[model samples]
Target: MATMNRQHHLRGVLLASVACILWGISGVAASSLFMLNPHITALWLTQVRMISAGMILLVFGQFAGVKPFAIWRQRATALRVVSYGLLGLVPVQLCYFEAVKFGNAPIATIIQYLGPFIISIYFLLFKHVTPTRPEALGMIMAFFGTLLIVTHGHLNSLAISPVVLFWGGLSAIGVATNTLLPRPLLPKFGAVSVTGWGLLVAGICLNVFGPVWQDHVTLTGAELALILVIIILGTVIPFLMFAHALGYILPTTASLLDAFEPLAATVFSVAFLNVQLTNYDLFGGMLIILAVMALSLNGRKMINFLRSFRTE
Candidate 1:
């Protein structure tokens, strides 16, 4: 029994690692597509990715006996799907891709990783929750890391464009929504089912603005392949693994393990895309990763503290 449990634990870690690797690599792939076609808007990519990946996940879930469409059968679940789709999924994709469009994937990813800090701050200010030592340390690390990344260790001048920073910061908040907003729905339906329906609904909502059909962008073979990677590796696989990992491991452990994502993304960007990072980038990114580790490992303690505060 011990050996079997150990094997399962190892398998979960491996799957989570592979999922993060795929996510990190897929961001570079998306960056390549954006580089090839400067005219290809982020909106187009979001629409295509959400719609295609969304359907694939839903259908795949059905085969796995997931019944993704079960959400539509419940009024509350159906409403949650719409809310998650529009506010949670759509904004995150739009902002993350737009950040990638403006900047390289590595920095954008590191910036997005600041989501947990944002959440911690919110709980501190609005929820009247005091952070424990770990949470406080995490918040400080995240803040300094973001500052270093943005200013490139030069607190006086900005390293990247202000426009890119705007989108990246927004995407970080979007990450918070993506993580926290789905909690209620996750208990009612499996993560896969809720995620699929959310993605589908998000795609539909995005399409209301203007369909990609209205675009003049042309897709080459390379572009088509990259899109497939983004849909499958980036969107579908990561979600599936991260969600599945929760079943076998603590969410905090899973979150700590996901630090590999930014590392992988950085390596891929430097190796394949010839994107170079400064010393500041590496150090700042490391600090942010430490923050992530702190946040994940200490999340429950912080939550308990928050509940105590509320009761008192």
Candidate 2:
């Protein structure tokens, strides 16, 4: 039983890793979308992506004996799904793409990584949770690292635009809420179904305001194909994997592992987006990476250390 549990744990980690990896590379696709058409708003793109991917997940799950519309049958479940959709799905996806739109992929990716730090603070204050030394230090490092990146080690001029900063911060909050909102629903309907329903709700909300069918798409075939990648690989697949991960591990742990998204986004940003880095940027990035690695590996110890300070 122990070995089986270990195997499940390892598998969960792998799934979470894959999810984050896909999310990391998603910046590349989003970056390409902005380049595809300066006129294509993230709003419209997101609406389309959500609606399509939601449909796909709902349809596909039927083959696996999963009743996609089962949530709609229950008033409470339906309400939760709607809430998760409007609150969770929209913010995380929309703000991320908007950040990527305003800033380059690397900047958007790194800034959004503030999710874990935000989570830590929330737990410490609201949940009265304690982090070990490693996690506490890691959170501190991540905070300063993010500040360094944004301010470029100086407060005079931010490295990215103010708008990017706003969107990025919102994206981080969205990530936190995204991870938190689905906990109740996951145990009831499983990952894919909950995600599908949430996405569907988000899609309905988004499309309610945007003219989906009437809007003329100026995207070339190649751009549409890239958007498809954003819809399927980035949105659908990763959410499913991460949702599955919640069953096996804590959401905080999954969020910790999500540091890879920034790294992966950085690589693609440099290689494809031609985003150049400076020494300060590299230093700051290293700080964030090291902190994430530390916390993810042994967060409980750090949480405990943090608790000691509060006690003293």
Candidate 3:
């Protein structure tokens, strides 16, 4: 029993780490595409990503006996699906891409780490739940970390443009909303069904603004391959792996391992994209990751608090 438990723990860690690494790499892949085609907009990339990944995951859900369309049986659930898609998933996808476009992936990813802090604040304001000591400390760390990144440790000047900061801040809200909104649906419909449908709905909605097929950006063979990698390796596989790993390990453990995402993003951005980072960037990023780690220590309380928001 002990050996089997140990094996499951190790498997969980590996799955979580690889999922985070792939997520980080996917951001770099998006950054590479942005660099390759200055004409490529984050809106277009997000639409394509949501549409393609949604369809693929829906197909996978069917094969897995998940009954993807069953989520639409009830009006409430159907509406929730649409809301989750539009308000939760779409913003995260679109804003994240925009952040990456304006800044590098590392900056975007680290900023998105503010999601937990946002959640904590929500609990305080709305739920009347006070954050535990660890949660409070983590929030302070995240604030200072983000401050360092924006100011480069100097309040007089900004390191990144205000535009990047704006989108990145919105992206963090998107992350928090996405994390919060999907809790009720996952158990009933399964992550595969909820996520797949949510993506498709968001994609369809985005299409009303501008269809991807109408976009006129020319793609080389290499860029096409990178898009495929972003869709498959970056989005779909990592999501599946991370979700599955949750079954084998504690949520706290999985959340801690997710810190690898920023590290992977920074490494890949520097190594592949040749993006430069200063000491302030590295140190700020470190603090943000540490904040995430601290929050992960309070994962159980956070989960319970989030669950309080779920409808009966």
**Best prediction by lDDT:** 3
Q: How accurate is candidate 2 locally (lDDT)?
A: 0.80
> Residue-pair clashes per candidate, as listed?
0, 10, 0
Off by over 4 Å in 3: none
The residue-by-residue lDDT of candidate 3 on 60-159, one tens digit each, is 9999999999999999899988889998888787898899999999999999878878878887898888888988888888888888999987899999
Task: Please provide TM-scores, in order, for all candidate models, with all chains considered together.
Answer: 0.94, 0.86, 0.98
- Model 3 TM-score on a 0 to 1 scale: 0.98
* Weakest ten-residue segment in model 3 by summed lDDT: 303-312
lDDT of each: 0.84, 0.80, 0.90
Candidate 1 scores a C-alpha RMSD against the true structure in Å of 2.6
* lDDT for each residue of candidate 1 in 6-100, tens digit (9 for 90 to 100): 88888888878888888888779889999998878889999999888889889989999987777788787688678888878876788888888
Which of 1 and 2 is ahead in TM-score? 1
